[model samples]
Target: MDRRHCLVTGANRGLGLEFVRQLLARRHHVVATCRHPGKATALNTLAGEYPGRLHVLPLDVAEPRSHAELARELALVTDGEKLDLLVNNAGVLRGSERFGHVQPADLEASFRTNAMGPFLLVQTLASQIADGGTVANISSEVGSIALRQEFRTPSYAIGKAAQNMATSLLAQALESRRIKVVALHPGWVQTDMGGEQAALTAQESVAGLLQVIDHLDEDDSGGFLDWQGQTLPW
Candidate 1:
């Protein structure tokens, strides 16, 4: 395979960090972003290990200004080259929310980070993405309305559901360029967010997700899928 340029958001830890590691292992050039690059010790360490192959930058996904700044910085990093993949991995889940006690702040934060941020980020960076590139939005199975069995995590659920719509719309918006956009569930990952008892480790989930991403065809754009490449109802 040709060496590809890729970018990953919230890449300081967990699945995002694993994505960066795996992409670098595959010999792809990567730009990894987080809210505070200076505070991202692991990513900074990876930058040393990978040398020029990895670049860690700052990005707060909920903020549009940060997106613009990232765009500017990305241009310099890629040196006019286009990116082959963009992973929208920054997300928030207010695990404390109950039905009546769901805070407005939680909802707003979740919506901005989970739904609006990814959509607007893609729009901002559309020109930077190569023709036939891929956009992978990290989503959750709890976002599935059809699969809902309880009222747990309303804020997260709602945000991801909206993100699902955003992914669909982006697929349409970028169809002419053949940019494949899809929402992917990383499964019950054993990350800080997923907790220690989750079904899969970050390495396992990211490995499977990468395989799924690598196999995506034109027909797979705008679809919802799990880490193992299984289709999930939207």
Candidate 2:
């Protein structure tokens, strides 16, 4: 495969960090973003190993100003070259409180981080993405209204559902440019957010997701898919 320029958000840990590692292994130029780059010792260590191949930047996905600042920094790094892939992996899962106990603040925070942040990040960086590039929004099965059988993580669920819609809309809007946009369910990966009892390992999930991403086309745009490349209901 040809080396590509890629950017990943929330790349300090878990699936996001795994994505960076795998992409670097594949010889892709990666710009890894996390809210606290100074505290991201692991990511910094990876940067030392990759040298010129990896660039770490600070970004808070929930903040518009942060997005703008990142765009400026990226422009300086890539010059006029367009990015080949964008992984909107930053997200928040908070307040598992059942119906009556669900606070508006929790819902608002989740929406800002998981839904609106990705949307705005993409919108801000659309020009930087190559004509035939891809945008993979890391989503979850818990967001699937069609597959909802339990009543947990309400805020996270609602926010991710909104993120799925954002992916659909972005795909349509970027159709002319052939920028494939898809929402991906990484499975029950064992990460900080996924907990120790989760089904899949971060490495296992990311490896599969990268394979799915590697083969995406115009037909796959606007779809919800799992790491295994299985089509999921919206």
Candidate 3:
């Protein structure tokens, strides 16, 4: 595979961090962003190990200003080169919310972090993305309205549903440039968000996701897929 320039959001830990690690192993140039670069010990250490191949920048995905700042910083890091891949991996989930007790604050926060963040971030960085580059939005199965059987995590569910729409819209918006945008469900991985008993490990899930990404074509844009490359219903 050719060396690609890639950027990952919320890359301090879990699946995001794993993506950075694997991409670096593949000898790709990676720009990893988190809310606090100073506190991201793992990513910083990885930067040391990979030298110029890895860059750790600060980005709070929920804030559009932060997105703009990241865009500026990214330009300097890549020296205005277009990015081959962009992974929108930052997200938020509020657990243990009863149907009636779901607070407006939680719902709004989830929307800002899960749905709106990735959508707007892509918009902010669109010019920096290569014409035929790929954008992978880290989505969840719980966001699938067609697959919903019961009431659970309404805030997260709603936010992810909206994000699905955002993905579809973005695909259409970038169609002329031949950029492929898709939503990906990472399965129930064992991470800080996905508890220890989750079905998959972060490494296992990321490996599958990367394979899926590697095989994506223009026809796959706007599609929702699981880490295994299985098509998911919107």
Candidate 4:
């Protein structure tokens, strides 16, 4: 296969960082983006260790203008070459302060990051991914209305639901180009967002996700798939 090039947003830490590390281990070219590259010492250090295998870029998902700027910069550098995969992993989950006391501003911010950010990121990079590439939206099981078992994350739930919608809508738009688009629920992972009681570790979650990704095809486009490869109901 040709050398794989992927762009992973929010790759400073957590699952995003893991994804970059794992992909780099596979000898793929990875563009790891974060809001503050200055503070991302770990990523920058890894970039140095891997040399040409890694490229760290500054990207703030909440900032719309940043996306276009990144596009122009990458285009200038690569001469419009297409990226093989884009992992829309930048997101925020503001735990609603208390049970019914959710802050409206926080909710909006959550939507901006989780929903609007990924949507805009994909839109901006649509031309950068070749016709037959893939896109992964890092969503959560809490967004699953069909599987809701009394989870109380109002802001995160709403944003992820919208994010899943984007997954389908993007699939529809890219279907003609044979690009596979889908949302991958990383599971209740033991990350900063997943908290202490979470059952699965980030490694386990991302492992399952890559497996599901390994099996995806155009027919699987628009589907909501759990990390375990199970189909999820919208």
- What candidate 1 gets wrong by more than 4 Å, as runs, is none
Per-residue lDDT for 37-153 in model 2, tens only?
Answer: 999999999999999889999899999999999999998776567899999999998855887899999999999999999999999999999999999999999999999998989
**Candidate 4: where are CA atoms >4 Å away?**
76-79
Q: What is the lDDT of residue 114 in candidate 1?
A: 99
lDDT of 3: 0.96
Sorting all predicted structures by lDDT, with the top scorer first, yields 1, 3, 2, 4
TM-score of each: 0.99, 0.98, 0.99, 0.95
> Which residue window of length 10 is worst by lDDT in model 1?
93-102
Question: How far does residue 147 in candidate 4 sit from its true spot (Å)?
Answer: 1.7
The CA lDDT of each predicted structure is 0.96, 0.95, 0.96, 0.88
Write candidate 1's Cα lDDT for 105-175 as tens digits.
Answer: 99999999999999999999999999999999999999999999998999999999999999999999999
- Each prediction's RMSD over C-alphas, in Å, is 0.6, 0.9, 0.6, 1.4
Each model's total of backbone clashes: 0, 0, 0, 0
Let me know the TM-score candidate 1 reaches against the reference structure: 0.99
